[model samples]
Target: MIHKQVVNHRQIAWLVGSLLMTGMMISFLRSVVQVARMDAWFSQILPIFYALFIAYVLSGLVEAYPGKNIFEILFIIGGKWIGGAINLLILFYIWIILAIDIKGAADFLHISLLPTTPLEVILLVFVLLMMYYGKTSLEVAARVNEFYFPLYFIMCISLYFLLVNEYNVERLEPILTSSLDRIVVSNFLPVGVYGDIFLIGAFLHAIVEPRLFFAAMKHGVIIVGFGTTIMLLVLLGVMGFMIASRLNFPIYILVQQIHVTDFLDRVEMILFSVWFPAFTIKVIVAYLAFLVGVGTFGGQRHYNTFNAPCGWFIVVSSIFGFPNVAHIDQFISYSLPLIVLVFQLPLAIFLLIHVRRKNKGREQSLIPEGTKLYRFYRSMVWITTVCLSGCVIVILIGDFFKDKSAVGGIATAIVFIALLLIALLTSYGEMQALNHGKQKLGRAKQAGSFRQ
Candidate 1:
């Protein structure tokens, strides 16, 4: 059995924020422009639901599994073969996420802040830090997260002071406008950004008291979501829709725009400083998730040995993941949400249902065949599938409705469709493969026992 260790409540909370919120805000600021255009601030109002929903699902998992981390729960519900498959996919996901973060940080610094430094140098430095932290236990990472989270928050809140002249409440209005569909679509930005919260489930084993896990998880998730929404709203208010949507690094740009005085013109540098701690937290979270994944499936007794190799692998994969920065932006804006919703939520739901079934001493459950709760969950499965299907349809329709003669518009649409299809196919294939492996294992075990 893996040993349990203590992490402070404050660190756990920051762990959630740094993992999902910090670097995400950079991407979120850039992507929100796709739907809301000049009304990006207005679109953000919808994510309160998305953020809360994600937290609720994660918290539910903690309640269902109690002391188990994500990998242990996967093993229990899916069985070893299937569970291992799912676990590996999660590992792949974390690795890819880390790559994106690395590339993004490198690109931002190279173009916006540091032109002389090579991309490789930036990436290597970041990965080195992540590797160092990854070697430590989850408890240490959590404490570090706790320490840095406040500094990151201070940097974000400092925006209000620096950009007071830029704030225009009127930029928030011309509200709603029969654009409910657009508003929901806009949710893709923050949803993709915030989906990293699921990684926190990997740390559940570190908490000794099973009952306290869910409460702590819920508290962390809700607080992080609340903080992100407020920060995004404040950013919109300070930058206005015009500038915020156009820039690749809206938050960074807003900080650069800060001119409290002539000498203070370079206050934007402080953002870079604060971003290090935030990024550090994010890297550690991804590293931990990847470590859990490898340890589950690769027969490794310890996770430290794989950290260096995994870091290098992530760097190489990230460079090839996107043909260019534009493609990365398009993927995040147009396709990432469907992947998160379909792949993540279903896994969590299956785990929760499986645990609940096992705890009730039934292979299935004792719920009446057509009980309300059963029916509701059944409906939810179908609804989720149908809603995701509709998202695909709507995206296609939007592409068809666009002016085809415009070369740039057509190119963007093609890239968008291709990326979405790739993500969907990959997620579906992994989930199916994992489930199938579990079923086969159960049958094999039964047959072996019969022969005996």
Candidate 2:
């Protein structure tokens, strides 16, 4: 058996922070600007809320199942057939995300820094570095994140100051005037970017301070949220939405505009160097998740053994996945949000229900009849049921009235109802079990008093 390694909360925070910052810093913001126009920054807010909810749900799973990662938790809740299917789906999603990141990085390098170099060579070198990191333990990855966090922070700050003179406050004027349809569509665009935080589910068990996991995750996400928000503001304010939308890599273009003096031009080269490690961290995390999923599905104790093959697979897929960068941008804007939500939202709801049921079972065993704590626990269950039911209703109603894509909306509504039903049944069963336990305890206490 491979020995598990534990990393502190700070390391976890840095890992998540780096992943989010790197993802946002790439070409993602252009999609948001495309939809929301000057109000692009508003689109980011919804996804932050979505990300926090996911973090909360995943954290509940961690607390319920102590040291189990998402794969183990899935098996426990879903059993073999259902859990295995979900696991495979998640692995496929991770593989695609990994491939995209690899391809994106290679494309960026080829376009900007290594224009003369062959794309294959650029991809090969990057993949080798990624495989080297992936072959090592996740602890090493965490440490790399820790080391890069400060440098990433400094570079972001420097970039902001460098571009300060170019910002036009008027460009961000007339913010909320965007059409409701466009705003709603834009709101969903960044879902995939923020949903990347869900990758933390894989590393939950490795957190040394499990009790602090949620807090650390929240902190990390806030860091990402603020950083991305700032970068978006800078991009919009500096280049305006039209130009920013047209640029292939808006942030890189914004960096290219940094001309402090004749000598200080071309600072983007230095910024790119600083940014490379952060991008690598994202690739590493995605690759690591892919490896973990493979190990979990295959029941292999030594996941690292598959590293070379998987890394090469990513290399080949990255090269052949899309004909060009335009395809990638199209996928990110139109396809990725729905794909990410399809995988993440349903799984989160399932895990949340599963963890709540398990916790209620443990409470039933421990708590005495008529105790305040037990009563409070039961009340909480009712509250949860009401909240979840309300969410399902709202989603169904919204889908029926507002969503333009009828099939997508209907599919989402169906998923919501299925999750709601599962939660209700679990809650009802736990209530029954709790009531029985209370009755048994009551009778025992009465018998003891009578005998005395």
Q: Which candidate wins on TM-score? A: 2
lDDT tens digits by residue: candidate 1, 84-103: 78987787667667777777
Task: Please report, in order, the local distance difference test score of every candidate based on alpha carbons.
Answer: 0.61, 0.71
Pairs that collide in candidate 2 are: none
User: Candidate 2: where are CA atoms >4 Å away?
Assistant: 208-211, 361-452
What TM-score fits each model?
A: 0.74, 0.78
Candidate 2 residue-wise lDDT at 31: 87
- Which ten-residue region of model 1 has the weakest summed lDDT? 362-371
What TM-score does candidate 1 get on C-alpha atoms?
0.74
Residues 1-452 of candidate 2: C-alpha lDDT, one tens digit per residue: 12375776667667877877786676878988988887675465457567767877876777687777787678777899988888888887887787778888788888978899999999899889988887776788888778787688678756668887887767875444556677678878888877788777776667533334654565566566556666776788898999988888999889888988886668888878878887798888888878887878778756887889998988998778875888887887778888878878887877778777866755324245466645754674565446454543544354355445545544443444454444334443443444444455567687763110
